[model samples]
Target: MFDTTTTPDSFARVFTKGRLSIGLITPLEAYPESPFPTLKDHQQAAKQAEDASFSSLWIRDVPFYDPNFGDAAQMLDPFVYAGYLAAVTERITLGTTGIVLPLREPVAVAKQALSVDQLTDGRFVLGLSTGDRPVEYPAFNIDFEDRAARYREAIEVIRTLSENHFPKAETMRFGTFSGTLDMHPKPIHGRLPIMAVGRSGQPIEWLAQNVDAWVWAVDESAAIREILSALQTSALDGRPPAYGYSTFFDLDPNPDAPYQRFYNVVRIGRKALIERLLHHRDLGVQHVALNLKPSRRSAQSVIAEMGTHVLPALEAA
Candidate 1:
């Protein structure tokens, strides 16, 4: 059901126009402290996202199911789930809310992501995270201390795997095949866009140097501005556009509270939501993914409500 009309770079256009294209962080809308969501939830939510006209969907990579950590993503693997979403939903971009490259084999990631890009007509945005989750790295037998270094190397490996038949990779994956092996079925436009999730393993400086776009964590406007300002000032790489994500409690149509929250406790109306959207645009956040989780509202109702209220504010802005 993925659309062939829009390419990965087209998603980038949403940034340049000072426009917003909302997406969801999977488990599709669950609590911050929830372990996992049902696969049925992911399936239904994918359809809802497409039906609601969300520009994209986001998923995260969690290698281990630490009880203390609380959130385990959606138990099924991220790319596998993305493929399922792609098959069922048309036009919405499917992406990793983030993949922790430090613990993963880059070549494997490259193969999986490329397959997804090709099969889904290239609607993939890379929310790549370096993975500071201490428990995950130990479980994977990866060094948490040097994740930043590994992250850079892994990115090189993934990029090479996608762009060339025989790529120069220096990491562990490169050891598997020293000679050339062509990575078949390149993405629709030959590649997917990679956006770094916060300043994961490396400094914000290195992230700006490498990734295509930036997504500041926690939907913090100030954090987004700080990083954006640093990127603008630093000479690391190209100027990058930035975005953020948050979760909503799904307030009623009419006003109750008159303000918003870091956890998205909004005490207001559609006008307040619109005003916030405009403020984010003014603050220079290009996209915001709302985690409709831990809410009193169910996924379907929240998606519908957000579409009616949130999507228009984004589109009109």
Candidate 2:
């Protein structure tokens, strides 16, 4: 059970205990031929998503474009883009698919997250990761092998700064806070909903105890169930943190097309999409962030279709 009283509005809206909410990952466009998105009409797409009753919008932190890695995620600073989205949209929750924590300073990250939370009137969720690209570690002059410890340290620093006034804290990577000064712009809910995006070099037990939510990319139902069960068991005070996943989604133009899988992406009709989401909801998934980067159709068309047909049916369910 989640304590709604303490949950941030964005977290609460995007994740309910028994229901699954849908969100889209940005730059909400299809570019199957290339690794980088044009970022054209992105703002409009975000507005359209909100207008269509989408629950949230997610951004990724990919500071560099690794030709070998082959995906320049969103191609913008997540915090800056989030701020821009916060100003443009009225109600949709803004989130980071994840910000790679070990590659940046924790206190600055805390301030940026808090600022976004305040700007959105509590419609922000902070998702943190250890980062998958080892190349990024050296670029930031950070030790890749030490990310696990740094990841933990960053969480501690962020929490201490956000949840307490004039907090005193000592950390290994980040320096000590001696209670001489306080971090400004506290979370709108008194605590920001911190999510562990991917494992972040930590175990499920650590995530269950520390984060407010967990988002990964697992597809197997049994694996999801086992992981969710473990998370619930290890969670503090028996309150299971929210669980969800991201997938490359391609919604077929036809309403009745069968569900088909292609590696990480799923190409399905609106009807099948609804059924699949319902199945996930039953499996205890609280949210799903769909990536449209691999779609064959235009992003706007898919958004319109989902808004007109899929969302209402899911709401009725």
Candidate 3:
């Protein structure tokens, strides 16, 4: 089981052992026709989410826009945006869907994460991934094939710096930490909750032992159950880490419409969405971060509707 004593408030707010929490992914406005969002009223939208009782808000790291990939992904640096949001929203948990770990220096990553954690008053969660964009690797002079190794190394560097005082450590790709120097501003809690977004090129067993949580893009209940079962069986100390997923959501305007899927997006009515989420809760999913970029309506409208309708229903359920 997770040591609640050492976990940040954001981790507990977002991931309970048996319940499901809902969060909105940033660029929290719809831009169905283009790759980029206008980011209009972005701050207001964030505050709206907090006011609506949404469990958290997530930002994505898209360092470069590959027109081929077609999504610009919020177009702001995630850490900077997260810091900005920290000031505007008081209670909502702030997080990254993930930072592409291999593309950035690990020590800098640790500093930024701790800075956001402090700004949020212990309301930040750090999600990291081995990036999927092959085009991005060569641009950074990094080998695409070596990301898995680098990803692991980055996590070690971040953790060692966060959890220890003047921690002496040697790493293959990220240089060494001398015992004479220490990273400043340790996590407000003893540690920041590190979530692995997607497999990040690691085996399930490795994730089970290393990360505080795991999230991917899986859509089926049975598939989720199977993966959760595998994670439970492989977990260290017989305790499964929290599990969650992200989805491109397109909520139907009608409250009674049935759940429908279109590739990675789910186009469903509020009622069925509630049922689906409840099902996920029963299956042991700890969080669900919804990306509303695919919505036909304005993202603000969707947020308002879900807050007024779906969130209350989930609470009652």
Comparing 2 with 3 on TM-score, the higher-scoring candidate is 3
* Cα lDDT tens digits for candidate 3, 1-317: 35756656678889988678899998999888899999999999999999998999999999999999899899999999999999899999999989999999999999999999999988998999976678998889999899999999899999999999999989988878789999879999888889999989999988988989888998688999899999988998887789999999999999898988888889999888999999888988889999999999888889899899888887787
**lDDT computed for candidate 2:** 0.90
**What C-alpha lDDT, on a 0 to 100 scale, does residue 209 get in candidate 2?**
88
| Model 3 accuracy (lDDT, Cα) | 0.90
- What are the runs in model 3 whose C-alpha is more than 4 Å off? none
- The C-alpha TM-scores of every prediction are 0.87, 0.97, 0.98
What TM value does model 3 have?
0.98
Candidate 2 lowest-lDDT run of ten: 1-10
Writing each residue's lDDT as its tens digit, candidate 2 over 48-88 gives 99999999999999999999978897898999999999988
Where in model 2 is the C-alpha error above 4 Å?
A: none
Q: Pick the candidate with the highest TM-score.
A: 3
Q: Give Cα distance to truth, residue 201, candidate 3, Å.
A: 0.1
lDDT of 1 by residue, 1-317 (tens): 01234334546543443666677777776453456666556677778878887777888787778887666667778888778877887778778868988878887888888888877777777678876478777777877887878878888877777777765455653345454676777767766677777577577566656776667555557776776687667534345445555454454556444555544444345667677777877777777766655555567777887777778767776
Question: What's the best-to-worst order under lDDT?
Answer: 3, 2, 1
Q: How well does candidate 1 match the true structure, expressed as C-alpha RMSD? A: 3.9
Better of 1 and 3 by lDDT: 3
